[model samples]
Target: MEQEGEVPHVLIFPFPAQGHVNSMLKLAELLSLSGLRITFLNIHRIHQKLTLHSDILSRFSRFPNFQFRTITDGLTPQNRTLGMFSDLIRRLNSITKPLLTQMLLSGELGPNPTCIILDGLFNFIVDVDAQPKIPVFSFRTISACSFWAYSFVPMLIEDGQLPIKGEEDMDRMIDGVTGMENVLRCRDLPSFCRLKDPSDPALQHGVTQTIQSLKAHSLIFNTFEDLEGPILSCLRRRCPNIYAIGPLHSLLKSRLSGEESSLGSESFNNLWEVDRSCLAETVSQMVNDVMENKRNELMGSVNETAKLAKTSVEEGGSSFRDLERMISDIRFLYRRQREAIH
Candidate 1:
């Protein structure tokens, strides 16, 4: 437990996927640096992935303010190989809430957490807040545009456009989704939204559960204004309490000392292990094929446009500003909580 006057504790729960876990971990690192006690929670399977890499384990273990914990994924031990999206909704619903409740009640972790930060994908965490005193914040791990696209799923369905029934129907062009023009097809929406069966119980359960959960808390997207100006505008109008903080890698890099930053190249999450020789040869051939295709596509047609398209979010951009804002908000919340208790 922290000293009485120490910083407030915050619990962070990332979606059980490599990309989402990595992004959320970076945010946790930033919060820890800002003098907050952070408990970073992962599903058991993902925790196994991080533990398998000794380098990653040693690095995180060295941080006193940042700790890691895991809860069961509700999969039988033998069925652990199933991918994250396979039966994900059921597993999360079955396990996370009870596990979190037990953890909060145990009083054995760090100081009691002031708030819970959850992955936007698992909006169910918002509904799990039976304790009115502990605030909840939704953390979005994907691009702002992708988050915006997901917000439209229900509207699209109501208008009789989505839940496309067959493979053939997937290729039909979708019209009138705001800010997105000439989307390739309904099939182009994220994989979860393109289910072939409208009556799929798991699909319906996951979608409805996630959408309903969004109504429970404030939202934070891992993106920035400049990178997604139009989409951010749309989300702001739809959800007022939205925060865009993203490209977390940049914010983390800025906080680390030079020596610590040098170690940042170490891989923190590798769900699959590949033999080096075979992987290298395969990757080289794939890169050559991709380069040849890109050359054909570009063919001297406005090189600047292609350059702009290829820009990264971490080049001191919108994600950077949002990180600053998120850290500030967390600090302010912690201060307010302390003042209330006193």
Candidate 2:
């Protein structure tokens, strides 16, 4: 039914979490705009949630070439709950490999995917590399600073500074991370990195698995160059193929026509309930006077830095240039595949 020399197809697998899924979806939209056929995959549970929203489903149905697919997460309909579902995620990660492989080899889904772009969190997917011909790229949905922090886990372990063992040492601070100037207290790092019990295997297992997966492929981080110059420079030296294409929402808004881009206006990645207790207490009259009197200087400096970073990612900025280059690369790959098949 179709002719030869069609666009190269891409399969995108976002880590089942909300942030990862939202970031990857933005990239998928950019790829689709470049004339590539995209098959966006999600865990079955997440897919069901999206489908339930009638407005979202209606918008999704309009993208004919950009299709949605799902693989079982090994989760039952009743298992969904509040807070971090670590056990369920671990089980889902383990089961994804075989299901993904089956989908790739089925042939029923059209030509095998030209490439598989996976979320950094789902490092287990990298293990399914039996089909080596299909290139895989890791999409890390975090700041370069955050990724750089993660990369130090092994060294921290070697130094006995991490994998916090017991209640007695919960307040320890870690020193000598490359980009961060201030000494980081244990609480400042991601919650998973602060596990106190040595018997708890998930924290260590996740760190090890993510590090091993990074070795398998090139990485694309959702951070712009100017915003993360120090960390991005360090990462580029360590991993040559790393691409810093981010603040992706801003980039997409600039490119797409007003109406087309608005589809993602309300899209957000926070699945957890908001905890505003700290803010509420801080704003109360008693604390407000004490805090405001102490130092307005520190607060102003932070705001200034944020504003500077925001301006640098606008049109003609570093992120815009990298995005252009990325689009060019995708177009070139599609052309080459078309030539080969013809």
lDDT of each: 0.68, 0.69
Q: Please provide, for model 2 over 207-258, each residue's C-alpha lDDT reduced to its tens digit, 9 standing for 90 to 100.
A: 7655754674467877877677878888877777676777777666555645
Writing each residue's lDDT as its tens digit, candidate 1 over 44-153 gives: 87888777743556666656777888887787666655464556566667777667777787875567778788877776644454766777887777666776666667
Q: What is the number of backbone collisions in each predicted candidate, taken in the order shown?
A: 0, 0
What are the RMSDs of all candidates, in order? Answer: 3.7, 4.6
Judge candidate 1 against the unseen true structure and give its global Cα lDDT, from 0 to 1.
Answer: 0.68
Best by TM-score: 1
- lDDT, residue 310, candidate 1: 30
lDDT of 1 at 17: 77
The pairs that clash in candidate 1 are: none
Candidate 1's TM-score reads 0.83
Q: Which ten contiguous residues of candidate 2 have the minimum total lDDT?
A: 265-274
- For all predicted structures, in order, the TM-scores are 0.83, 0.80
Give me the runs in candidate 1 sitting further than 4 Å from their true place. Answer: 1-5, 81-88, 126-129, 169-171, 209-213, 257-267, 279-282, 296-317
